[model samples]
Target: MATDYQSAISSTLQRIFGYDRLRPGQEAVISAVVAGRSAAAIFPTGSGKSLCYQLPALLLPHLTLVVSPLLALMQDQLSFLNSRGVAAASIDSAQSREEASAVMAGVRRGEIKVLMISVERLKNERFREFIAQVPISLMVIDEAHCISEWGHNFRPDYLKLPDYQRQFAIPQALLLTATATPQVIADMQTRFAIAADDVIMTGFYRANLNLLIEPVASDDKQHRLVEWLSPRLQEGQEQPSIVYVTQQQSAEQLATMLTHHGLNACAYHAGLPAETRDTIQHQFMAGEVACIVATIAFGMGIDKADIRNVVHFDLPKSVENYSQEIGRAGRDGRPSDCLVLANRDALNVLENFVYGDTPERDGIRRVLEEIAAVQDGSGECRWELMLTALSQHSNIRPLPLKTLLVQLELRGVIAPRFSYFAEYRFKYLRDPEALIAMFEGERQRFVQLIVETSNRARTWCSLDFDALYRRGLESGVNAERSRVVSALEYFNDKGWVVLESKRMTEVYAVTPTPLDIDALSDDLHGYFKSKEESEIARLNAMLALFESDTCLSHRLARYFGDMQAPERCGHCSVCHGHVARLPSPAPLPPLESQSFVELCDQIIERYQAAFEGQVPGVDLLTRYLCGITAPLFTRLKARQSKGFSRLEAYPYAEVRQWVSVHLTGDQ
Candidate 1:
């Protein structure tokens, strides 16, 4: 260990970042990374997790690769590092071919010490092939909790990161996340083969945020949201706020309602185009927008510290989600409000999302059979071919299919070659002949050769990089694909084309063994069912936090592995007597009443009626009436139907109760 390590960190913290000193837990994590050891740091939101990796990235001799889940997070961290004068660049789809090429060039030339990339890039065979040639000193996994099944936000892709580590032989790895329970912590350490002593956690307690939960009636949630937000919209009190919702439709409706009430508000979800979401986030961060009514997608990479309020208009899906979202507020160390309008009815809606993800045993069987059919005698199957065939043959969705794929990989029934390139598409911006004229002699010959190899003459065509490389071989150029990509990037920079590409999503080859397809498929179904149950339990834990009698912060701290939390923080809803006592709504208009049975019959009839050769199930109908989407409904093209959200304005509980009794017979 260098005795000057502390001095180095302190001087860098003060000189480069203008910080007084390293924040709590940062120095230790950074030390571990510097010493080529693995560590997991579970710092709370507003605490600087990036510094743990950023400082070491500078001191380390080789490039540090940061694998992040969200595009916004990568871009934001890249911008922050550049602002601090650190040479950082990210490989994101939003970047132009020229921009991505510039990043790749910088990494190869050692001009970029820190590189940020989405985990999805690992799915790109070409990228993985490219990374194999690079010398990487450190691997940083942000939002590391996503690796564990016990985590609130379990991303299947993060589970593959451990393999990437061994592939690159990355000596030093660090797992950075804001929220992780004790279970998630244990899982990360086990999966990454990390040491138990390497886990570093900071406190989750935030004194500046006043946590409040209002137990409003489902019908009154809208009014309560308005009541809380209207005052903030007043002159001189134009503090930015985020009202979290559960559904894309609700986000739009709520934002529209807010705007009609004279508030500058907008809705955000993945359903909106990427450009629109980016614009909304920018406006919100710039203070041009007062409020953003968003779903979970809106908060991940947003670093706005002065947000004065965070309100959960619908129930949050997990204790981790609640804590992380509310943590967005008061980041500037100023007092801010954290409010949740808890309604029991919202639980059914939240739980339905969990149920929607669990695929049937038959669906898992179909997926396995498809893969088996595609597998050659060598037990290898093209990942893209299988996925495409399965998608075309059945209505099984990506989420459930991904879970099954992960289950198969975990079971040793199949293995994923995560580095395979899937497909790449591009659109020409200028005339093809004119663009081709820019190249002459060898350049012109090679460009034409690559284009002829691609075989996609029209707009939105896929290119075979491997085939193109083969053509390059015939042209006596060893760096053929790189040259083609570089030329494409050059054209893009010159406004001749807009290029886009995606790596294949996890291709796997079947393992040779005594086969038990039935048993394996059943087990996969259980695996996904367990995931659903885990998510439901997480959601309940969030509600449990709201319902706790102790101080809200204390409960939150204890939930995130802080058993020593004080009984009284004196800043929560419980401490202030804002228990949010609720009055019961009128009984569900009598189960057999005209208002009840007709709505119930309508719900049953709408789902029982098939569309696109797929029948909607109880779970799908439940989500439909509850105003949420089940995975298959949209894929089956039923969402465009006239009655998809007939009961959208009603309480989820009311509709769910009637369906359970009348249609499902209470299961």
Candidate 2:
């Protein structure tokens, strides 16, 4: 007789997924899951990674909780799972109380077999308790690399996942990702306590992809891209491709430029409205659009097997990132192109982004003091107030503040209370006057006041009730931010507006302990410093791909624990002799032409002169030009100065290098 493992998986693959056989690594990973052993599946993108869990979800008796990185991701996968006639549901802030209750009911009734959620969703006490009632057979972590500090894209929230999983005593766990280095893989294995044999990794070699690197100067990069695409456009060909840019703005500009010049192009980035992003994703997938110019945010949930090409309009920040992005192409095991328009400017931008994360000791100290000052009247446990507090202390945005807050919580100085949005925005599709006219008594007057206080110049307007309350509109403030949220929901239900209230940060309550402010601040500073160094190394690794004479696949494969990787592969630029040799352009301009070098020097001199003993280092100067406010800069309130982003168009490393070389002699 066939064993239970072999018998069940074979039939499920044929019937449920309609696959003739398991993809490489799928069988082993699925086997590990079914046998109740924790495992990490380090498969490349589009390598049937989801099936490893999907099949197990069907096989297991209890609910398999999946934590995806993005909201759209969970929705996309849930839709597919439901279509396959599997019992699945998701509980998130996007759902109403009644809707979430219905999902919770389904879980209680054992009607839902799989539930997907974001990592941050677990922080809510309600969610934690609700999930406690449900039996968790396996906890699946998609994008598992995020759990490790050494990961290319580390998220602090992931560090708590193991502890969270432990609460359930979840019998089995699986970690999955498209890209991970040997170090990242080791980190994940240690975190999950996976055995050597259970940690499955498929080699990162894509033979069908033509990995080509073109070294072009800053001026010619755009033109070179056009020249490559124009012929394909002229032939009236429709090849589903993605052009990855360095920023959301560039995605828009480049996509618009391409559309105007007669190609079916659309821009995809995190900055776009969620609905618009969903539409673009569907359009691109259905072949309604020929290409999408996007940042790194576009391709996570895409499993399209026939992507014809993936063009890097700018250099990627890390080899891990580059591998994950390009892996989207050649998924069908068909010939496809992976082109990188390599240049110096992209490197500067990447380095600048990394340098900006390290805040000064004073800024960290200020944040802690504010948290301590505000606690239970010694502070406010409310997340909204904490955001307002941070704004007053520094120019640190909510995104970085979220990371910093997580670090603080890990240090046990604070305990997380909750998180909510500070404000919300929605577009009124119906007549505002008519809607106001619906209420006639004192209620109508309050409604009118709320509307008048909001920005109604555009069809889409936003309201921050706290501001109205602080500005003395106690009528609406009487209900608090929740009352305003309810009104938005009411209008949404009435089809008066489209609501998008997904922005916010987490709030933590203070623990009963005097924080060793100096030592903790120093340790936090060192943590950020180490992260910056690690990120800088990652960027350099990506650069090495361009500089090295080795096979592209081999270069990538070896990074992910494949020591047996060959030096020469017939598919890459070096092996095929396709690496282009172009002239190095003129160096960055000097002081007279208003170059960043001169601006950097001026900014540094001013800082040192103003603050007697304090010297601005390369990291600090880099952060300023990149519009990144380090703690010291925030303490100095230098973000308000005009010189903050004077040389922003150049690379951070290049400008910083120039400044350091010049300053050593002067100092």
Candidate 3:
């Protein structure tokens, strides 16, 4: 049987992927699947992890269910599998109702050997019904770190998989990821209910990939990127590359700049229309676009193999994100470069980003004061912190707290930013033909405007209602706006168009519905305070990663719990030059002259009219006054100017601290 399996694997490799033999761990992972044993494979990025499960799904009689995190990844994998003559399908939000139903039917009938889906889809009652009827042989969770709160990318829905595992009674399962620290691994095992002996970890080392971090002044960083990239892209040797930025506008701007500099580049981010993103991704994969300038939203589930470089145009929020982003390089075993252009200003920008998004003390206190009344206060770990925070608003746990915490830490949010979904709706009056025919007066013009505004393309359209309403007012149709809106609403009710609205709410920590308000409140408060401290600690740790003169790889490895030699890699910027230190300033004596309330009132009045009477929380107001362009404040036109001209002389940190104390009544 083993010999037969090896022969099948070899034949599949040659016939399907045009490879001669399996990589190091592929055979073992395949063998475990063939034997019907649960297994976890921790291979480094670009190590051909997908083939481990894909090949077995082809050989086995049972259908394979692959739970993926991103819709783009699901589509890419399905496309690749179908191209290779394998029967595979994916169901995601992108799929039409008919398509999804057909896929479900195929799974139940054993016609589809592999079905790819997101974890959230599994929670759907209809999908659950179909899953119960299918004879699934293998269950795979790609990006398995999402199951752990400690993992850098946590998805709360992943925590619910164990229940599905029990329901399906799946004898074999595979949890695969390119990155996982020891804590993450342990958390995955606990969450997935995997046996300790089933875990297979390959050490994190990619000798062919040279990791380099260059600390330059903010303005010079772009110049260094251009210089490094130009040498690599000489006339006959343009390699596939990805340059990650934190902002969507930056992605577009950088892509345009790079294209002007003679690089074939395009921008990729979620902010663009879906079709545009799809076109750009396809072009990049086909080598039509030599480089892609993207926000962090661009690369989940991407399977492109010959990528030669991964450059960070802006610092990522966490070391895990940095590792994951850079891991996209050198997957084809060729020498690839991972470059990060860091500076003191970037650090400050990141810190301000963190401070700004953290829920204000009042919000934090509201939830914490409630949690402080709970009994689970002493026994709770970091995961409990997430659960309590989410439980404050809703009965259902919308997101896994553990995963959210990791994401917040990576994004430099001192606390979890409230998560919200976007919803939209459109309506039309009269029969479809009548509406098209009724364009005889202003009614006709309004109808034309609605059609033009809502007609996104052939299949679907997204109307920016705000923009449309403004256009209506500009055109002197302020009173007619109501009739137009009413028509759209009517069409939405008739199912001719979509009506959508999204709200952000807390994900509850418990499932059975808590009856003890006091206990829940106590637990919530304790978790909030603990998370606040943990976030601060994580930020300091990231700072230390930059400050160390040691090997970047070694520092990264140590952070992930690999106790290896600390010898300098000699490839990073720190090893090549002296590590720069931050300047220490003298501490100021306590301010005794002005009371907290008196000072806050003075500052509020000074900036009240400018800020529209509602002062943004302390940290935000401070960043604005200090002339810093933090992410949140940077979006507003009003905050950009030196409006707080009188307050410019005072230190921002002091003002922020003073305002915070007054707002919380701690002063």
| Most accurate candidate by TM-score | 1
Worst ten in a row by lDDT for model 1: 591-600
Distance (Å) between predicted and true CA of 493, model 3? 16
Local accuracy by lDDT, each model: 0.77, 0.78, 0.66
> TM-score: which is higher, 1 or 2?
1
Per-model TM-score, in order, reads 0.83, 0.82, 0.70
Candidate number with greatest lDDT: 2
Worst 10 residues of 2 by lDDT: 377-386
Which of 2 and 3 is ahead in TM-score?
A: 2
lDDT tens per residue, model 2, 1-667? 2388889989988887778898889999999898888998988888888888999999898999999888778888898889888898888868875687799899999899999899988888768888887898999999999988888778878988888888877887899998888888888888888998999988888778888888888788778888887765554577888999988999999998888778788999999988899899999889888889999998988878889889998888788889999999978889998998887655666777777665656667777777666555443343234564575464455555667777887787676666676557888787779889998876676567667777765466878576655543555334356666777777886788777775466566676565677888788878878887998888877787777677877888888887666677787788887655433445666533555454565566667776795777665666676666554565555766667877776666665665566656532
lDDT sort, best first: 2, 1, 3
Error of 1 at 136 (Å): 2.1
Question: What lDDT tens digits, residue by residue, belong to model 3 across residues 116-139?
Answer: 989877645557777988888888
Better of 1 and 3 by TM-score: 1
List ranges where model 1 is wrong by over 4 Å.
271-276, 379-383, 386-389, 416-507, 512-514, 580-586, 589-667
Displacement of residue 161 (Cα, Å) in model 2 is 0.4
Query: Which RMSD does model 1 reach against the true structure?
Result: 4.9
